[model samples]
Target: MTDQTIIWLVLGAISGSFINGLTGTGTALFALGFYLVALPPLQAVAIVALMSVLAGLQGLWVVRAAIRSNLPRLARFLLPALIGVPLGVGLLASIDAGTLRLAIATLLIVHGVYFGFRTTLPRFRARTPIIDGVIGFIGGLFGGAASVSGAIPSLWLSLRPWPKAKVRAVLQPFNVVVLAMTVGLLFFQGAYNERAIHALLITIPIGFVSAQAGIFVFRRIGDTTFRRLLIGLSLLMGIGIALQELF
Candidate 1:
C-alpha cells in the first residue's frame, strides 16, 4: 500500500472502532468513507465488517450482564433478523442498492432531525415485541442489501428509556452477529485476499486502542447523555450516508 493508503486505513480503523466502542453501532458510518479513499469498495466493506465484529466483541462484554438479563427481548429482535438476511441477499441482485441506501438515508435524516430538536425525547416504555421483530428484520434486510444493518435499529433503540448498558446489550450483539454473517459471506466471495489481510493487520491494533479510549468515555457518560449522543449520531450518519451516495 502507498503511504496515503496506509494513512487512510489507520484513520478509518480509529474512527470506526472508537464509535463502535462508544455506541454499539455506527462503525461503518464513520469508517467506510476513509476506507473508500484507501481501497476498493468490496475490500473497504470487508475490512469494516471485520473491524465492526472485532470491536463489537469488547462492547458485548461491556453489556454482558444486561444482555444475559434480556435474553428473551433480544430473541424477539434477533430471530426475525436471522430469517431476513438470506431473503435480502436474494433480492440484492434485483434491487438498486444505491437507491435503497438513499431512501434509508432520507428516513434517518428525517427521524434524527425531528427527535433531536425535542427537549424531552419521546420514550416508548411499553414492550412491543412485534414492532421490534419487524425493525430487526428490516435492519437485516438492509444489512444484506446495502451493508447498513445498524441504521434502523440504532434509531429505534435510542428512543427507548433503557439504561445505557441495556441498550448497548441489544444493539451491540445484534450488529456483531449480523456483521459476522456478512464477513463470512465476503470470505466466500474472496474479498479477503492477501492485500486485504495486510491492511487488516496494519489497522486492527490501532483500532483496539481507539476502541478502549471510546469505552473509557462510555463508562463515564450518563444514560441521558448517551441517548443524546445516539440522536446526534443518527443525524450525522444520515448526512454521511447521503453525502457518500451523492458524491
Candidate 2:
C-alpha cells in the first residue's frame, strides 16, 4: 500500500477503536469516513466487517459474566439473526458496488437523524422475543450488507428501558457473531484477498490500543453526554458520506 493509504487505515482504526470503546458499538459508521476514501466501497465494507469482529469480541470480554448469566435473553435475539444472515449476504453479492454503497450511506443518514433527535419520538415499553428476533433479523441484514449490523440493535436497545450495560452485553456479542458469519461467507465467496488481509494486519493492533484508551475515557464521563455526542457525530458523518457518494 501507498503511504497515504496506510495513513487512512491507521486513522480509521483509531477512530473506530475509540467509538467502539466508548459506546460498545458504531465502529463501522464512524470509521467508514476514512475507509471509504482509501478503498472501494465493497473492500471498505469487508475490512470494517473484520475489524467489527474484534470490537464485538472485546466488548463481550468486558461483560462476559453478564452474557453467561443471560442465556435466555441472548437466545431471544441470536438465533433468528443467524438464520437471517445468509439472506443478507445473498443481497450483498447481488447488488452492484455503487448501489450498495448508496444504500449503506442512506441507512447511516437515516439512523443518525432519527437517533440524534430520538427524544422527539414517543417512548414505549420494551417488547418480547418476537420483536427482538425481528430486530436481530434486520440487524443481520444490515450487517451482511454493510458491516454495521450492530447499528440496528444499538438503536433499538437505546429506546428500551433496559440498563445500558444489558444493552451492550447483548448487542456486542450479537454483532460479533453476525459479522463473523458474514466474514466466513465472504471468504467462501472469495471476497477476501491479500490486500484486505494486509490492511487488517496494520489496523488490528491499533484498534486494540485505541479501544483501551476509549474505555478509559468512557469510564470518566457520564452516559448522557456521551450518548448525545455519539449520535451527533454519527449524524454528521452520515451526512458527509451521503453527500460524498451521491454527488
Q: lDDT of each model, Cα atoms only?
A: 0.91, 0.73
**lDDT at 85 for candidate 1?**
76
Give the Å shift of residue 193 in candidate 2. Answer: 2.1
lDDT of 1 by residue, 22-140 (tens): 99889999999999998888999999999999999998888899999999888877888888777788899999988999999998899899999999987889989999999999989
For model 2, name the residue pairs that clash: none
Stretches of model 1 off by over 4 angstroms after superposition = none
Best by lDDT: 1
Give all TM-scores, in the order shown. Answer: 0.98, 0.82
State in Å the error of residue 133, model 2: 1.3
Q: In model 2, where do residues sit more than 4 Å from their true spots? A: 92-123, 223-241
